[model samples]
Target: MLANPALQAFSMFLVGTALTLGDVHSHVWARACWCLTDVLFLMAFVQWLRWPGSYGRKLESIWYLRWGGRVSLRKAAEIVYSEARAQESVWAHAAERMSLDKSPDGILCYIAEVIKQDTTIYGKRPPSTHVEKLDPLQLKYGTVTNGAREVRMRDNAKTVFTDLQVDAKELRRALHEVRESLRTTMPI
Candidate 1:
């Protein structure tokens, strides 16, 4: 976080300008340095929230903001999607899907205990990722957080998250499906 040169320079410059813009002699030079440090720390924490962090961290942050009661579910998903697109490695790739026992959002997923809620998704039970091939399950139901605010993008009409979900029922079924269809494979 401290390695961001642009952020460091900007925070320093802003603090310096503010101090100098007023009566310079009113504040000690050493005090100004401390002020700059404080500003830098504050900016760093605030800016850190914008970074596309590790998958779980990023998911939790977005989920936190989304369910923070500040915006609607669709609006939250849209906000996260837009911010993710601006980052280098985008949030959730739309092309591929993985099927196994459970989604990455398992029992202990939420960042804060306070955020653990049964309102939208059950946090206590390990969610079932399995489903019939009729339609893609909402990622939220599976405790995942990439697709829509609902987890697996349930209503593509609501959010832009488009993570594909293939129903890999069993090993033999998966093998047969793989041979039958040439699907793009993604890393686990």
Candidate 2:
């Protein structure tokens, strides 16, 4: 119907927004309608448009940076962790123990997960964590939506981190073993 100007005009007439050529009107003549889809398409075809870069593209591109490599991921995670820890709140401490994943996917997931927790008691259930695969094409060209507003993952294996338990006795044993090994191998 949109392809047929007559049909479109008739529809517009039914909607009372049609203004045809050679049509004479009274003192007041004003009509408006939404008929620009084709015009928009034509304009889109006529222009050389640049698509947007994804939020993760830059991070991913520098993933294999010859100088720092994966150190970048770890460092970014450490900064995120430190900032949260510096909040000095119970939630901050708990987030500290989250054992955040130290990779590109991990950092994104961590940020998205962290900001999802609202500081309100509105009785609204927090949105559950969701595992969503990122499309390679979309990740290459399209922008990521709300990466820090909700907890989203590419897959179960893409989880930002896991809740871990600390065992005091096990920690002490590991430290003692490390100390003994270092003393015996002393280059110091």
Per-residue lDDT of candidate 1, residues 1-188 (tens digit): 56874568576767666776775875676466556767777776667666655667666645545344333233333333334233312132221122222343321122111121212322111144432222223433333343223333335454322222221122123223323433235343
**Model 2, C-alpha of 17: deviation from truth (Å):** 4.6
> Which candidate leads in TM-score?
1
Could you tell me how far off, in angstroms, the CA of residue 51 lies in candidate 2 after the best superposition? 6.9
> How much is 48 displaced in model 1, in angstroms?
14
Q: How much lDDT does each candidate structure score?
A: 0.38, 0.33
Model 2 lDDT tens row, 23-132: 54731342443344344444444331221234364344234232331222223333344334333333334443552655444444453343222111011112324433
**Per-model TM values vs. the true structure:** 0.26, 0.20
For every model in order, what is the number of clashing pairs? 6, 0
Q: Which ten residues in a row have the lowest lDDT in candidate 1?
A: 107-116
Best by lDDT: 1
RMSD of each: 15.5, 22.8
